[model samples]
Structures are given as C-alpha cells and as structure tokens.
Target: MTASSSAQTPGKKDALAGREDAYNGFLIDLEGLPSSPEALLASLRASEAVWRERAYRGIWLRLPKRLAGSTGAAVEAGFEFHHAEKEYLMLTRWMVEGQPDALPPNASHQVGIGACVVNEHGKILAVRELYGPLRGTGVWKLPTGLVHVGEDITETAEREVLEETGVRARFAGVLGVRQAHNVAFGKSDMFFLVALTPEPGQTELRPQLEELEGACWMDPAELTEQPHFVKRPLFQSMLRACRDWAEGRPAALHQRKITSDDEQRRDLILLRSTGGEDGEL
Candidate 1:
C-alpha cells in the first residue's frame, strides 16, 4: 500500500480478511472473523507470514466486542493492545526487524454540542431529560447531544435542537466551550455551548418522548429560579454566561471556511472568535 509497493494482500484466502495500509502495513478487517480461536490463530499466523515475506512495517488487527473470547489467539500472535472504542478493540504488531512501533495515538477526546436557542423575544429553548445528571430534577437546560462521526459542530447544533425540541433553528455561532475529564465512555469531553436563533415562525414544541421529560421556550429568568440552579453557583455562572451571549456583550465565535494553496491541508473550516483580541487564537 506504500507509494512504491503493489497490493500486498495475503498469498491465499485466510480465515481473516486482510488489506494493505498506506504505511506498507496490513489491517485485518473485523468483519467475518473466525469464531473458533484455533482457526483465528492459524489465520493470524498465515497473514503474518505473508506480511513478513513482503517486509511490511506493522500489522493492525481489530476484534469486535463479540469476538473478545478470541483475544488469546491474537496475543499468541504477538499482538498488543493499541486502544479500544465502544464497539471494538484494536491490536497492533511491529513487523520490521529493529523498527520501533510508530503508530499515532487513537482519538482520546469526544466532542459534545449543546444548543442555546435564543429567540427574538430572548426566551431560551430548553428541555428536561429523562436521564443523565439532571434527570427528574425539573431543571430546564439547553438541548444537547454528542456530535456524530464526520459531523461538524454547526450541523450538530441544528440536528440536536431539531431532534430534541422539534425546533428548526438557524445556527448563529458558538457561545462557549467547557472541558471536563472522565466523562462519557471514560474519555475526556469538550462540551460546546452553541448559539442559535430559532426560526422566526417555527418554534413549536415537540419534545422527544423517549429521552426528554419536557421541552419548552423558557424565559432566562425562569432558569435561575429552578431548584437545581439555585444551590449550584457553577451552573448559575454558566447560565449567566448564556445571558451575556444573548445580550451580545461577549462576542461569539463565528465560522469561516479557510483554504490553503498547500494541497495537504486545504478547505479546512475554522471557528474564530468574533473579536480578534483572543491572543491564543
């Protein structure tokens, strides 16, 4: 798969499906994995021999959660744990003699987007979840969700808001971002507070029945009066920041598409703070 080499597939059809990687390595497909541990071990050995003959640099093996019992066979083949996702575990082996492992780290942080829909009248779109940290608390908060694979923050805001509240909103800009550790799936998360303006005449409420207890247009003052918001000064500060965003005191980040003449990094979309004073940017 490297620039100089031809397709380096296995010499014969083995029990496991394998393909070449861009780095002159082999990646074993996770689907149709052998159910029998003995068969899996034999397949790995055959694939390894083929790659070894071609002087491949490394081998990547993925095992689905259902095939976890076959892990011993992969370990016997000299594979070590690289990382794991919600659905599968990744294993790797260095193939070239004396060449150290040179794989990039797997993704470590998840991005979650929250929609803060402020209308012309300044009422915020809010929902009460049937689960999570605020379940049954009767606290009205922004409709939020995790960003899907290959989805941008702007799309995520519109999709989540429409899903949770049936409100088709216009994506304005980003309000803020919050980072916390040891969150969902034992990974760190970056929660975005996205600013949105509800469609002028389409703000009808249709709360998601399964996951949400209620959804409505809430006055900003009403959020401060919720019992859950009363005792926690931190949440209060968060909402206060939202209020500031609605009033246009603190300029939000605006989205801009940037392209470079360099082919390797062209057409990248970036979110820049409205005020250029952010030295960190």
Candidate 2:
C-alpha cells in the first residue's frame, strides 16, 4: 500500500493513533525554537518513533502545509524542507558542540516596547500612538516603544514611559515577560511586565501626533470586556498584575488569555461611547 493509504489502513491506524499521542507528548517536552517544523524536530530527536515516521514519509511530520493544505508531492516537499533543516541543525550541533544541550543560545534579541502600570484606581498614563500599524486607532494602550541599541531594558522602559506618558515614574519591579507570535509580521514580540511608581494625582497626558492619535486613561476593567483589548497585551498583563497586587502575591502573576473576538466588539463600542472616533477605521 502507498504511504498515504497505509496511514488509513486498519492495522496502521492503530499504530499511527498511538504515534499521534506520542507526537504531542514529545512537543510538550521540546525546548528549542518551534517557529518551524524542522526546529521542532531537531529539538525532539530523542524519539525513535518520530524519526521512523520522518524516514517512512521522507519528511518532517509537523510540516505546516501537511496540517493545512491539499495533499500532493509539493505538500510532501514542504515536509521534507523541515526534515532537512532539522537534520542540518542536528548534525551541526553534534559535530560542533558534541550534544544538543551544548548548542549556542538563540534567545531572540527584541526591540524594546515600553511598559506602564495603571494603578488600582485604573488610571494609565498612556501615549497616543499616531503612526504605525496601529495608527488612527482610538484604543489608548500603555506607553510602549522599541529599545535603541546599547540601551538597557529598564532604562528603555523608564525613558519610554516618561516620553510617552509624560510622567516621571520610578521602577517598582518586574511583573513578567509576555510574548505573542505574529504570523503576519513573521516575528514574535516579547512584552516586559514592568511596574511604574507614579505621582498620586492625575498627570497631564499629551499626544505626540507623530507617534499617537490620542492618549488618555480609562478604567482597565472596562477594556476587559472590549475589542481593543485584543490589541493590547499590556491590558491583559494589567489584570494579572491587579490580581497579584490584591492578593499580596505580586510575584505569582501569570499571563492571561488573549482577548476573544466577542470581547473586541464590546471594546469598540466602549471607546466609541466615549465620543472617541471609531478606533478600527
């Protein structure tokens, strides 16, 4: 039988089903960059079943096209690309470092995006970001920006906060790091959860039209039910931060789920109700 047909045959079905379970289990234990199937395979080399599947199929099992598109030789080639990439990383690591664990670090170098903490009172000294992918959007997000070369993360945070929010705030402590995979941008963003110590009163927030359309602070919980929440990881982190702050478990904060489509529509309404122009246009 052909390999495709064999996968559907009764005898092979049972083995493949078991393999599917094992594949998931292997993925859970892998640590390398999983942006691509080949990267995943290289990191999961200890599994013999996975290796055999790759050999029999002549490709990596986790090829994206195999999961998404029509079955064809090209689809199979997509799998092979991943397989070859995995093989290359494996051989290079084995020869150079003598073990996968000895391989060089690949921690992503991130462009710094600033962090801001809205207090228990639900006030955020935010920036009006005017020109970027998110420009002309009425959603007021926490003041954030990329770190220039030679700038420390904390220094970058402090600078961006003051520049964007118009408040001289002190660093409180780290909240946690948040990351999201952007398939459209072909990059992942790492958002640092930072605490900012600000003055007790409402500060005059300004809008740099070059960077923002508008800037202001509204209730954080209000956005939880809105659509703009989908665009702001800072807002999600704020919820966890508030929870931890309330519970006196500041260091125990965990990342929250990304906002859903339903929530986004609600936020759009909330922002528009404020006499703010529609953020989505």
Candidate 3:
C-alpha cells in the first residue's frame, strides 16, 4: 500500500511502520479526556453545510492543514480516528461524551459482533465458509450478525451463532473496530471483534447447512492458506483481532457519531425531520 504524504510525519510514520510490521495492526485507545460538549455542539451547527453531500475518504477531508494544524481545537475536542485503509484516516465529528451516535447518517444505528472463539489449544476460533458474500465463499469469517432493534449487539452475536450454527459462547474483550465501504450496500459499517469462549460441553460445532451452505473451523496458520478469507472485512478484522489477542493487544475503540458534525447540528437546529423539503436551507 502507498503511504500518503501526511503519514510521513515522524509520529505518524513511526506508527505506520509499526503497523506495517504487524501487517494491519494498531492499538487505538479511545478512553481519554472528553471534549467540551457545548462548544463542540455549536461548531457542528456552524459547519453543517460544509460537510454535507461529500464522501471524503481521508484525514485531509476533515480540514486542510492550512486552516488547521496537526493539533487543533477539534482534536482537543475529542477527535476520533477512522482507518479506512493502511494509510487513509478520517476524523469523526463528535467528542467522546456523546458517542456511538457521533457516526455518520448512513453509518448511524449499526451494530455488529465478531466471536473471538478459541479452542482447547488456546487458539482463537475462525470459520471458513463454502458459501456467502465472499468471492468463492470458501473464505474464513467470524460468525457475526447485525443487532436488531432493542436487542444488544452481544446478544445478536450469540443468537446468530446458535441460529446459524448452534453454538453457545461468552465474550470477554473487544477485538477491534473494522471499517469497510461497500458500494452495493451504499454504506459503511463498523465491526467489533469480541473475545468469546464456548461453554463447557458445547463442542459440537457445525454450520447449519440450511442456514449456511458450508462452514469449518480454522486457526491462524490454516486461515492464511485460504486467500479468499482476506477479501471479507469481517474475516479480515477477525484475523487481525486474533493475532492481536495472541500477542495480548487490545483493539482501538474510536467512537464517533455516525452523523457529520453539521448534520447533527441540523438535526438539533431543525429538531425534527420534515416529510417535505423546505426548498433550500
């Protein structure tokens, strides 16, 4: 992957180099001081028009270095970082205080889970699918699902696993946040890797053929053999999480409102969704 010009800074470069060696690995700790809620909220109002109707894919999209510096009021106000690819980054619109909601409009209200399953040998669990969204469907993927309304994300994972494969398990730590852009879906989703362990006597694991065309268990080494696995965001995220867990690392949790700062303010300013347009704002 080509490193972007901005990633050349000493700090960014060092981090990128370390991440490369790890091969798509990095620790993002979102647990820190929160930003000023009101000032941040106000700024979102003033900048709403600028961020609308733009699909910017990099850090430069947030604000040029000319108008803003490496450190700005935005960063101090709880800036969030989204890793689109190895070198690309996107800053989230809200501070830590009001999160999970800070996501973009298209990205809002999304929740998915990944099982950090491990076997008797202490190796993390993974599955190779003979069918599904992947190219040949012979790809490794973490058993995951979308959280339904009122259902918890964790519960969705467990229920999906049982419904799709019939395995009961528990989760421990978070793997990492995965970002993927799908033209087909016309949206982006963040997948959370969760550490999970099957309950005792729950060893009989197999994909319900009716639900899934085919599925099988695989470890790190075996996972690499099947190239198709890398194509899936969930699988790729799971693999990265497994490797991180193997090395005792934690996935970064950068929570941002799915809505752009401006949209959020617009929502607040207008305070309601009108069925009809108001000509132009």
Ranking the candidates on TM-score from highest down gives: 1, 3, 2
Q: Highest lDDT: which candidate?
A: 1
Q: Listing every candidate in turn, what is its Cα RMSD in Å to the true structure after a full C-alpha superposition?
A: 5.1, 17.2, 21.3
Q: For model 1, what is the error of residue 26's alpha carbon versus the real structure, in angstroms, after optimal superposition?
A: 4.0
Residue 99, model 3: lDDT of 32
| Ordering by lDDT | 1, 3, 2
Show the lowest summed lDDT stretch of 10 residues, model 1.
1-10
lDDT tens readout by residue for model 2, 74-116: 2332322222232232111112123233323333446555465
Per-candidate Cα lDDT values, in order, are: 0.78, 0.46, 0.48
Model 2 TM-score on a 0 to 1 scale: 0.44
Score candidate 1 by lDDT.
0.78
Worst 10 residues of 3 by lDDT: 12-21
Count of clashes in candidate 3: 13
Cα error, candidate 1, residue 7 (Å): 2.3
